[model samples]
Target: MPIMFGRTIKRPPWRQCKVGSRDDLQVGQALNNKVMELQEQDFNFTIDTAFTKEIRVERLPKGFKMPTIEQYGGTIDPEAHLESFKFVMLFRGASRRHHVPSIPLYLEGLAKSTEWFECLKPRSVSSFVQLGRAFIANFMSSRVDRKIMANLLAIRQRSNETLRAFLTRLNSEALKVWDLDPIVKFQALRSGIRDVELKKSMIMDEPADMHNLFSRCEKHINLVEVLAAKQEKEREPEKKN
Candidate 1:
């Protein structure tokens, strides 16, 4: 049976892709139409569209975890073999859709690509281990260690923004570069690694510290702004001596 299964996404992402003005006229109209279609029962689009072959997903880090139907909280395909699906999705671009939230997008792909799902077989544990080894070897072979280091340290150019803004901007860039160079995609994976690390620390650390790290960045920024304003005021003398 085609293991591919997922739902439609007509909302949740509206905020992320909100229409602003004439600046984004075409894309905005498209998004608006998608929302309206889903809202109006006329929408026949399925959110997921990935052709799945039984592939194995490596042990997913906690945050990269997808939803399963069994989870009362969200969907998780214990049978999902996420790594395989993820690799294919990355290798062969998925059928594009908008408004689908993070994990659900994945499920939508499965739901949409029943034929693709039919061809896949669950990978063996040994084969997966070999693939991991091969992956490291292949990755390392492409360039010497120094180049890898250079790529690792090279940060993308983007202005400072809140976490939400950062994600939106990051997603836009990711879509842009997804095909031109896999490096762009690789960079995104690295960011996911960063996110997973933060989550790990937050879950393990004391609540106060977690809050401090998340909230402190902005708070410190505000404090700097306040202090700078105060300094500027001092430089300007009042009319009365």
Candidate 2:
């Protein structure tokens, strides 16, 4: 199925009705009751949205910009997509931020991010949807995590190439996915902005895991037993007695 975009809000067809406070929504059946009350109070305006309007959401274009909250006359604002990337980097620390993509051999696009971070974990339909949207959006925007994903994806294909080369291919493939210029991927890769590893393709394009392997840190990280190894090194020279 084609991916859908945008918030789907079904306008209620009913006259103006009083909606209880947010606390009202906490009740198990308050929502249904409130809807009933609204319908009873204003039958004319209250209409089922599924029947009234057919809202279809399509995928967003590359570099598609959303209007800032000022356009909506709202005080609150959503965080820029770039901020999310920074948070991931900051959360991981500066040194660990700029490393080559090191995705696990298994896991797919989202499961990796979800598995690693409690904050990023998707426990509900809403959360799952939110995470998915962020992932796709990030993928489209050429975040360094893109290289991490590409590495996982390349490994799945079993191509005899290092992640660096795989990312070059993934960047190429991302262009195709978003219907952008093929050369854009090449240019970005070569420019060192979107570039990952420096190796050339040893094997042609193939499937790979491509999960949980995103990073924008220019620094490197050891995916293999890094935690315990770091701890071991931290000890005082094994306390030579």
Candidate 3:
């Protein structure tokens, strides 16, 4: 029975002999290392993609001229200065120069005598808009000083000035104080007129606002000038005949 059992215990289906060294066991580990390395490379690639998306690469235009506020007729109007600068930027893009270095170029446009230039001298600016606002505030303050605004409000039509010339002087001074209330502005302009007929018409029937008043006054002044010119022409013909 023992012998039969021993015979029945067939030789193990296969002989157990080691075919590889300890280094061979490391093969699986090396494969795992390779997989981790690939994962790391993918992670780095993803980071680079995200970084590139976040940063904008602006190329500067060739031979671009920087715009200055003074170049646009020395305006104290912040809106005018900023708008003109924006127009330049728009033109540059239209000319195929979309991305340009802006900080240095914007600084170049600011007046050296301006407080904005002095205030920003030691600072690093990242945005042109922010710098522009500062410049606007500084320039506007200079234009709208209390004394200047007061002078504008106190302006009277000079005795020797024609209606057109007086209006021009008044408008030039008023433009410097851009923040006055509309009603106040209209009253100031109305008070300065020397023409009794116009003043009576204004008092009897006030216009809707300053714009309406200005339009009516302008038309009246133009009509007066036209009549005067016609009279002069008629007199010349009569004299010649």
Best by lDDT: 3
Order the candidate numbers by lDDT, best to worst.
3, 1, 2
1-241: candidate 2 lDDT, tens digit per residue: 2234855655343312336744444553766777666544423222121111111122233554332212111121212333444344345442221211111212244434432333232221122234334444434534333233333233222245544454555556563333344344343333332223421221132213222222321122233236558787878587763
Candidate 3 lDDT by residue in tens digits, 38-66: 54452432211212221225444577665
lDDT of each: 0.39, 0.34, 0.59
In terms of TM-score, how similar is model 2 to the real structure?
0.16
RMSD of each: 24.5, 22.7, 21.2
Name the TM-score of candidate 3: 0.46
Q: For residue 135, what is the lDDT in candidate 1?
A: 30
The list of candidate 2 runs beyond 4 A from truth reads 1-182, 193-197, 200-241
Model 1 TM-score relative to the real fold = 0.22
Question: Considering lDDT, which of the candidate structures 1 and 2 is the better prediction for this target?
Answer: 1
In the range 1-241, model 1's lDDT, one tens digit per residue, is: 1233575545444344437645457667887897766544522233221211222222333444343322111133222333444455444443211111222344343333334222322222133333333333322433222223234324343445434454454445554331334444444423433334444544565234423643643454466568779998987786346
Q: Single out the weakest 10-residue window by summed lDDT for candidate 2.
A: 47-56
